[model samples]
Target: MANEVTTAPQDTRKPAFWYGLPVGYMSLDLLPPAERLMEIINQLRGLPEQERDEADRALRLYAGIISLLNTNRVQECALGVHPDDAGGFTTSVFTVSTLPTSGSAKLVVAGLAGSAADGPDEGMRPLELPCGVGFLAEKRSPAPRSSRHPERSDAASSHIWQGTVAVAAPSTPELIVLQMVTPDLDSADDYRNILLGIARTLTFTDPARAMAADEDREPEAPTGASAAMRNDFG
Candidate 1:
C-alpha cells in the first residue's frame, strides 16, 4: 500500500491545457438513467459554501454538478479537483485533470470496468482508493499513472469499479464523468483522487496508454474550474 501520486511530464512541451483538470464540468445526457445525474447535482449543491475554520482548506479545486437527469448507469458525473471553494478563480483543478501521468487515481479507475462483475461489495471504495495510500509510479510515456498496490496485498476497497476521468476540454468528441458512494471519503481531495481515476480510465483504450493518458482533449476558454463548469455543464 503506497500513497505516492505521479503525473506524466511532457517532452519539454506542454499541451494547450495541462491535461490534469478540465476547463469545467461536463454533462452525460447522451446516455444514462437520468436520476443518477440528478444525484450528482444534488451532491454538489449539498457542498457547504462556507470555508471551515478547522480543516485547512488545502484544496483549491473541486468537481460538482449544477443539474443533470438521473440514469440507471453512470453515463457521466461532474468531475474536477479543488483550488478554492469558489466555482472559478483558480486553474489548480485543471492541473489535476491534465496530469500527464495516471497516478494512483487513474490506475484504480482504468481497472474498474473489468472489476464490476464481482458483485457490488468489492474492490476500491469511493473514499478509499483515491484517498488511499500508495507510492507514485513513473512512466516512460509523457503521462504516467501510479500503481494502486504495486505490491501484493489485500485487494482494494472501492464499492464500484472507478477510475480517473481525463480532464479534457468539453469540446472533445466524447467525455466521461464518475463518482462513488463510500463512508470513508470526507474531503475535496479525496473526491479529486477518486474522480481523477475515473478520468484516467477514459484516456486510452489500450491499458498502457489508458493508464498514462491524462487530458486527451484541448483546453477551452479560461473561466476557472467551477465557474466554467456552471456554464458549460448546465
Candidate 2:
C-alpha cells in the first residue's frame, strides 16, 4: 500500500460546515438500500465464471454488505455533535461512484480532539496534516484461484486513505479526520485526489472566539405583549 500526507495552513472560518463531493459522484443516501443491493448483485454477475467459487463469492458479498453498514453508521454519527470532557468527535461517510467499471469509493470524516493520540498497537500509518496528524492503511484478501484459470490470480484490495487535522484552539484543541477507501486499486488514485481536495476545505475556529462572537450579538426583543408595549412606548 502507498501512503502520503499533505498539509496546509489552518482556516479560521466556519468551525462546522458541510463538505461536498465532486461532480459525477453521489452519496449512498441518494440510493435506497434495495437499489444498492441490486447493484451489488449486478456487479457479482459481471465476475468471470471461473471466479465464481462459493467461498470467493461469499467473501465478496460479505465485504459489500459490511461496507454499506459501516457507511450508514458513519452517516448516523454525522447527525450530531459529540463533546467529551476535553473535546468530542463526530464522523460521516459518503459512497461515490467514480465510473461504471471503476469501483465505488467511501469518503469519511471524523472530528475529535487534537490531544488524543493513536495507540501503538494500531496498524495504521501516520499522515501529517497542517492542523494535526493522520493515518493511512490498506488491506487485501486473496481470492481463491479458479481451478480452471490458473494464470489469473490477483487478490482484491481495499485502500484506506485517512488524515487528521488539529485546529488551533485556545484551550481544547479541535481535530478533524478525513478518510476515503477505494476497493479497486486501479482507481484508488482518482478517489484519493478527490478526498484530498475536500479535506483542504476544512476550517476551524476557537471555542472562546465563537462564544465571544455570540455574546457580541444584540439580543432580540420580546414578542407578543412585550413587543406591543415596547413598540407603543418607544
Candidate 3:
C-alpha cells in the first residue's frame, strides 16, 4: 500500500429553487391570468382590515424563516386550469423536490383532485404552510445565482396548517408536497389559491411541463427523521 488517503464522500446536495417565505408559494410555469390575480388581490384588499391584517401577519411570520432568491439555477414550472373552470384554464408549474424539512414520516393530499405520481400520500392534512416557499424566500441573500446558501441556523419553526379548500369538480388539488428523503411524502395540500399567486405574477405559461409533473412518478423512500426533503410546495 502506497501513500493512500481515504476521505468520506462529499455531501453533494443542492436546493432545487431559490429561498422564499415558508408561507407564500412560487409558481413555476403555472401562472394565472392577470385579471384573476388582480381580482384576488382586490378581494384581499376588500377584506376587513382585521382579516387582511391576519393574512399579512401570516405572510410576515413565514417570511422570517425563508432565505432569499437565487435566480441563477434553472427551475421548473407548469400551467393548468382552475378545477372549477369548465373551460379548463391552464396556469402554474410544479418543481421536483424532496422536502423542505427533516421529517421521517410522510403525508398525502389526494382526492377528487388528482394524486401525485412521484410520491406517496400521507393522507390529507394541513401542512406547516410557513415551512414552505413563503418562509424559505423571506429575504434575499447576497449569494450568487447558483451559490450555496448560508446555513439555515436561524430558521424558526411555525405551525401553519394546510387545511382543505374545496373547488367545483373534475378537480385536482393544488398540492404542497413534502417528502422525507428515505423520502415519504409527508404532506400534500389543496393550495390552488395559494399557488395561484405565483402563477399570476409570472409570465410564459407551459402546459407540457405542468402535465409532466402531475403525471405519476414513483414515490421516494425515506431515511431516519434526518433525511433531506424536497418540499415540493407548489
Best by lDDT: 2
Q: Estimate each model's TM-score.
A: 0.21, 0.31, 0.21
Question: Which 10 consecutive residues of model 3 have the lowest summed lDDT?
Answer: 1-10
lDDT of every model, 2 decimals: 0.32, 0.37, 0.28
Per-residue error (Å), model 1, residue 139: 23
Over the stretch 37-108, how does candidate 3's per-residue lDDT look in tens digits?
567567778789999988766644433422111131113322233333354332222332222222312222
Candidate 2 wrongly placed segments (more than 4 Å): 1-17, 30-72, 76-132, 139-177, 204-234
Worst 10 residues of 2 by lDDT: 98-107
- Candidate 2 residue pairs in clash (backbone atoms < 3 Å): 131-166, 132-166
- lDDT of candidate 2 over 1-234, digit per residue (tens): 011112221232222422333333333332247767677677767887766566466856666765765544222111212222445432223331111112211112122122123445342444443333343433433434656556654443323333222222222332234445433444445545545554433323333453466568776643332232233223
TM-score of 2: 0.31
After superposition, the stretches of candidate 1 with alpha carbons farther than 4 Å from their true spots are 1-8, 16-112, 117-234
| Candidate 3 positional error at 221, Å | 28
Ranking by lDDT: 2, 1, 3
**Predictions: Cα RMSD each:** 19.9, 18.3, 20.8
Which digits, one per residue and each the tens of the lDDT, describe model 1 over residues 1-234? 111122221232222221122334333332335686576555555666663321123221121221212222222334333454555322212113222233444454444533544436433333222222222221111212226444423243222222333332222222233333221233434445544443332322223243234336465442322222233223
Question: How well does model 1 score by local distance difference test?
Answer: 0.32
TM-score of 3: 0.21
- Candidate 3 C-alpha RMSD relative to the actual structure: 20.8
